[model samples]
Target: MRNEIALTLQKALRELYNIDWQIDTSIIQRTKKEFEGDFTLVVFPFVKQARQSPDMVAQSLGDYFQQNLHCRFNIVKGFLNLTFPCQVWINFLKNNYTNTSFGYFATGNSDVTLIEFSSPNTNKPLHLGHIRNNLLGDSVSRILAACGKKVIKVNLVNDRGIHICKSMLAWQKFGNGETPESTQMKGDHLVGKYYVEFDKHYKAEVAQLEAGGMDKTVAEKQAPLMLEAQEMLRKWENNDPEIRQLWNQMNEWVYQGFAQTYQQLGIAFDKVYYESQTYLLGKQLVEEGLQKGAFYRRDDQSVWADLREEGLDEKLLLRSDGTSVYMTQDLGTAQLRYDEFHPKEMIYVVGNEQNYHFDVLKLVIGKKLKKEYGPRIHHLSYGMVELPFGKMKSREGTVVDADDLMEEMIIEAQNKTSELGKTDFEDGKASQLFEMIGLGALKYFILKVDPKKNMLFDPEESIDFNGNTAPFIQYTHARIKSLLRKAADHQINYNHQSFNEIDLQKAELDLVKMLYEFPQIVKTAGEMKSPALIANYAFDLAKEFNRFYQETPIFKETNEQLRDLRLHISQFTALVIKNAMTLLGIHVPEKM
Candidate 1:
């Protein structure tokens, strides 16, 4: 409808002033609620082109729309407000109200988009921060796929690093042959326990060295525990048989634990890449850089990329002992991904702390090494997820465990739902409901915030069945489902009914208009790479439907046509809510 109006205005300009104008759809926007129209056109840009005052241009355009398109318009200053007739909205609803996949684009686009997220280190289990990364990456992948882009979700495990060595050393020294089966703990958590133990003992060693008059920095480097961990890392890199076995065993434990948590959160990856496997690729890149004069060898025989000319400091690619750094593995991983998928875009969903790291990655790959696909690298850098008290540290064991948090969310959901007297669920159904509400609350709370901003997650607040939380939206869906069931019980057949003759109430029209915006919202969210857009759009649509439900009668209406139209509207709204939440990697329960 907005497109038709824009085209009509363009024709008006050509007819009246003999001026050919290109109409941009962006100029036409939904009119603000305070305004009296459905759509608003900013005529200021056209004012100069038409050689008239802003108000005159708006009035002329409004008159043209009112005449040609049968749209009623009210000119407010320089804005042309156009309101379409009821039949226009009816036709739109008749066409799209029954579409099960209303807002989703058909798939099969060849533009591959590879998203790398949930880059967990084997030294610790997934934490609150990993939750945000996984949810963001997963949701964005779903959104892009909905927008007709072929998306490949990938995970890169930091399995070979100093951090992993710390955990391995701690386990070897203190584990005393204890295993996940022996201790009955999750594998990642068990390994994380040892990682913290290593930190505790390492701190003591550092303190002892400092007491002997060594500087704090020197004491830290000279700590026996630190030296042992470094040696373990070297041994592992050298493929020492015992170290290799230990490394593989511990990484497998972490992977198993990670799989359980990912299942709980409903996250899956199309491909999993490990640093141990990809780091060699990074070494090859460094060697190539050396041959191309893009990298220099330091006196200590370490390979370095001098990016100071590109506004970055020299980055260490290989250590003096010929060990690969994180950047080295990342370079290899990037090339491996591009060569495998040929993705048009490669997004790294990492924290904002690594902003400079990704910057260096792009610069080194694009400018220094001059790779053609280097410019496709995008760092979806997001802010940290801090607790109310402060930030978390993995080595210090201060991070919120992902498994523990998920269990808490489920328990909270159970308590809240029980309090609401919704305990009539059948056998095993209540547990399923709890999982849905719990996971829904977590995903919505995290995804509703812009990805670029840091968020403080309050579990109790997110589980509430009010405000912008997912429970509220889920309950709204449940309510609509109940209504549909009630209609079925009453033998109301709304399937083939004609809605053109019925006049839509204000609330009903508002909801239909909101529904009309879903495709656009999905498109905007995809382009911006932000799930917050879809999250808030679902909220608004639900809120509007609730208002419509309260003011407009569905089952109570005496006119059969009016009742049928209301029921159709409710059904369509429910489909949209379900679809939108699905894109956010959240499930909405039919009964919540």
Candidate 2:
């Protein structure tokens, strides 16, 4: 509908006398309710080219519409108020209401996109940070798929590091083989607790060893627990039977726990990339760069990439001991991904703290590889999720555990539903509704904000029943479904197929306008890679739907034909809301 109007005005401008410029129809905005029309196209941009007053441009466009166009038009100052024929809107609603796909399809141009996110270290359970990363990555993959992009979602598990050893050493020294089942705890939290225990015990042990007439350096180097963990890592790296068995056992438990959380959150990946597997990837790349004269080797045999001219300092690609750093592993992953999918685009849905890291990556691609791929590499770096008290600190144990947070949201949703007297639903249905509501709340709360801007998350504020919230939209869907069921019970049919016979009211017009804009909203959100646009559009549709519901009656209307028309409009509105919500990775429950 928006495109139709824009093109209509574009043709009018082109055919107009003394108008030599391309018409800028980009300003076609929905006018306020107080105004006379549904959409207002401002013609002020063409004043310079038209060499006439804004009012003259507007009048000329209005005259063209009245004389040459099928749609009605009016000139309100410098804006063109255009209204479609009543049948145009009715036909649009009729088509959308009956269509299965809601008028969306893949663009047929398939480009593989590798999305990397949720790289959680094994030392701790998933936290709020992981939640944000997972939501963004998962939502992005879904959106890209909706737009015909073949997206491969991958998680680069940071399974090996000092962090992993902390939990392992703690378990070996103090756990006494106390398994997750033996301790009756979730595996990740169980592992995480021992990680905390290791820090306290290691600190006290270091102090005691130092007090026994040992220098700080000697005491630190000779710490028994630390040395034991290092030995464990070395043995595991060498594929020692017993150590490898223990590593597998622990990581399996952690994976089981992670699987539960991911399933609960509706997050899934096509492939998993483990750092332990990919850590050696960058070494050969660094060596290749050196041969190609793209990198310099230090006196101690460390490989360095010179990026100072690019406003970044020299970065060590490989350590003096021939160990790969973070950059090297990334380099290897990129090459490995190219070999696997040869993605036209690679997006890292990492945190904002790694901005400099990605910058160095782009620099390396330009100077070292000298490869210019059309599909751009994007770092979808979202801001850190801060708590009300301050930033989420994992070491201090102030972090919001993702599993616990999701559970709390479900509980909150159940309580709210119960308060609304929604207990009459069947047990299975109630449970499903709760899950939908809870997950929708979580996804909508996260995606509504600009991904790159820092935002405070108040759990109390996050799950709200009103004001651009998930439940509010869910309620709108429920209400529409309820109305449809009622209409069916009353045996009302809308097959008269004549829309011009009924009088068009304000509420009906508002609903029609909102429904007409869904395709435009989908296109805008997809092109910008911003789900917030869809979120906002969903809320706007809900608001307008609610207004129509309150002001107009469908089942109670005197004329069965008019009532059926309104019902079809309501049905189309519900269909659109459902479609938009799904794009944001949210579901609409029939009841809330």
Candidate 3:
């Protein structure tokens, strides 16, 4: 409707006033509630260009709209409010309510987009922050796919270097050959435990040295555990048999544990890259940088990039020992992804702490190294996920582990469902219901907030059957489904009835108005790269449906035509709720 209006207005403006201003659909907005139209267009912009007063411009556009379209319009001040007839909305529902592929526009020729997220280290388990990263990446991928982009979800596992060596050394000394099986723990958790042990013992060693009257900085460097971890990293880098074997075994265990968590969280990656395999590519890039003079070698033989002209200080790509830093590996990985996918865009779903790093990366790779794809690297930088007490620290083992948090979500779902007196489901399907509700709550709570904001996740608050949480939307969907089933059982068929035959109530028309906004909502959400738009859209739709359901009667209505309209709208609402939730990687149950 906005497109048709925009085109008509553009033609009318050129023909009437000889103006060539480009008008778009964005100018045609929803009419304010106090007005008496479905949509409004502020004509003040054209008042100056068209050489007319505000009232004159509104009147002229209103007349043109009435002639070119089926909408009726009225001008108040400078606002041209247009209201479409009943047949317009009736056609909208008839054409789309039954179309399962209504809003999704992805095709074979869509632009290729690669999103990298859920990059985890082998030394630790995924924490709450990781959950947010995974959810955002997955949701954005889904939204992009809906917008007709060929999306590829990718993961990079930080599986090597000093961090992993610390865990490996700790397990070697203190694990006493204990395995995930022997300890009855998840492999990632088992490995993470030893990582915490490494920190504890390393700290103790440092403190002992400090007590001997040594400076704290010197004590830290002289710590035996630190020295061992560093030596182990060097041996692993050199492909020593013993170090490599231990590295491979511990990494395998971590990978297995990661798989389980990803499955539970409904996350999947199209491709997975490991730092261990890609570090050599980083070294090659460093050598190339030196020859191209994009980077310089210091007296100590370390490779650095001078980026001061770009308003950033010098960056270290490689250490004096010729070892790669995070920037070096990232440079190679970015190039590697381009070589493999040739994606139109590469998005790194990382925290905001890396904002400067990505900035330097773009300048160094795009300008200095002159990689064409460097300018396409987007850092979807998000703020930290803060806890009520403070920030979580992995070394202190205070971070909320993903597995443990998921388990807690399920328990919360179960309790909330039971409290709401919604536990009448079959015993066989109860667990499935709980899992769906549990994960749905978790995903929605995190995804509903704008990805750039720092959000405090309160598990207890998310599972409430009331409010904007997933459970609320899920319940609304379930309620509408129940209404549809009842209509089905009673053999009340609305399939052959044309909704244009009825005098629709204001509430009924309002529901249809909300439903018509879904496709546009989806388009806008994709363009803005925010799932919060879709999340809020679904919540508002559910709230409106509840309002409409309360004020209107379906089977209880004596008028057959009105009853059919109610049932048709109910079915449509349920379908849309399910569709929107699915885009957020959430599932809505048929029964609450």
Candidate 4:
């Protein structure tokens, strides 16, 4: 519709003023709430050329648009406000009410987008921080796909690192041959417990050494546990049989735990890359960098990339012992993805702390390796997720485990649902509804905040059924569903052409406009790469529907056509709410 306005202005300007005013469509904006128009156009730009006052110019342009487009107009200073006739809006509702894929689009060309997220380390279970990454990545992927992009979601597990060895070494010394089956602990959680134990004992050793008058820094390095962990890392790298077996065993346990969590979150990876498989390719890329003089090696034979020109500290690509760092595996994994997918863009949904790391990566890949895909690498750096109490530390076992958090959300959802006396479903159905509401609340709260801003996750605030929460929107949807069911029970079929000519109230018009904006909302959200836009849009639309519900009568109306029009609008609003929530990886229940 905005395009129609812009293109109409293009023809009007050319014919009226002999001015090829190349249709600056961006200037055409929604009119202010105080105004009487649907859209406003600035007329000051044509004033001098037309040899008229700003008011006269606006009046003339308004007349030209009203004549050409059949929309009524009012002029405010140099702004031309145009409102289309009721038929235009009613026709819009009639044409689109039944189309479920109303907002989906077909693009000019197919573009492949590869998104990498949830790069969990084997040393710990996924925490609240990982939840944000997973939600952001999954939601963005959904949004992009809706916007007509071919998206492949992937995960890179940091399966082999010294941090991992810390857990391995701790399990060897203090685990007493513990297994997940015997202990009834999820594999990942079990390994994470040992990781915390390693830190506790490692800190104790450092403190004990410092008690002997050794310097803190020196004691930290020379602690017996630290030394042993480093040795275990080396042995694992060298593929010692016992070390490899232990590494594989523990990682398998973690994988099982991770799978369960991913299922709970409804997240799946199109492909999973492990550092153990891709580090050699990273080593190959480093060698290529060295050959091209993109990096330098010290006398200790460790590879480094000098980025002082860019005001960044020098980055180590390889250690003195020829071991690879995170960058090494990342380089290899990125290249491997490019080779396989040839994506137009490769996005890494990592935390903001790795901003510089990705910057350096792009610099090396583009400036040094000079690879074509270097320019394709993108880092979707997002802020951390902190709780009301403060930040969490994975090493200290202070981070909120994703599994436990979801469980807590489900329990809270049950309590909240029961309080509302909405527990009338069969036992199994009631349980399922609790999980849906619980997870929906969690996902909506996290995704509602802009991805670039750190968010405080308050479980209590998220599970509420009022004010910008998922349950509110979900309940609104369920309300509509119940209304439609009741309409059926009364033997009132709403499908008919009579409602198309039915006069619409102001609230109904507002809902019609909101429904029409769905496509544009989706397109804009995709362009901005923000799901918060969609989340909030869904909330606002739900609120509008509720307002319309309260102000307008449906079944009780004396006019059959008017009541059917209201029901049609209500049904369409519910569909939009469900679609929008689905894009955020949330489910809207039929009952709440």
Best by lDDT: 1
**Which regions of candidate 4 are displaced past 4 Å?**
16-26, 43-54, 107-109, 311-313, 458-463
Give the residue spans of candidate 2 off by over 4 A: 17-26, 206-224, 373-375, 459-462
TM-score of 2: 0.93
Q: Best candidate per TM-score, number?
A: 3
In Å, residue 77's CA in model 3 sits off its true spot by 3.3
What is the C-alpha lDDT profile of model 3 across 1-592, one tens digit per residue? 7788889989988988888977678787877667788889988888888888998988888888888897799989899999988878777877788877667775779789999999999898999999999999999999899999999999999998888999999999999999999999999999999999999999999999999999999999999999999999879877899989999999999999999999999999999998888976778877887899889999999889999998899999999988778998898999899999999999999999889999999998998899899889999988788876678888765687889888988988888778878768887788888888888888888889898999775534443546988989998998988898888899988775566677667778888888888888888988888889999999999999999999887789998877887888888888898889989999998888
Residue-level lDDT of model 2, residues 172-220, one tens digit each, is: 7889888889988788888888898887887787899989988888888
Where does candidate 1 clash, by residue pair? Answer: none
lDDT-based ranking: 1, 4, 3, 2
Q: Write the per-residue lDDT of candidate 4 for residues 70-116, one digit (tens) a residue.
A: 99999888888999987788788778888888887775578999999
Q: After superposition, how far is residue 292 of candidate 4 from its true place, in Å?
A: 2.8
Report the Cα RMSD per candidate: 1.7, 2.5, 1.5, 2.1
TM per candidate comes to 0.96, 0.93, 0.97, 0.95
Regions more than 4 Å wrong, model 3: 458-463
Clash number for each model: 0, 0, 1, 0
> In candidate 3, which residue pairs clash?
106-148
Clashing pairs in 4: none
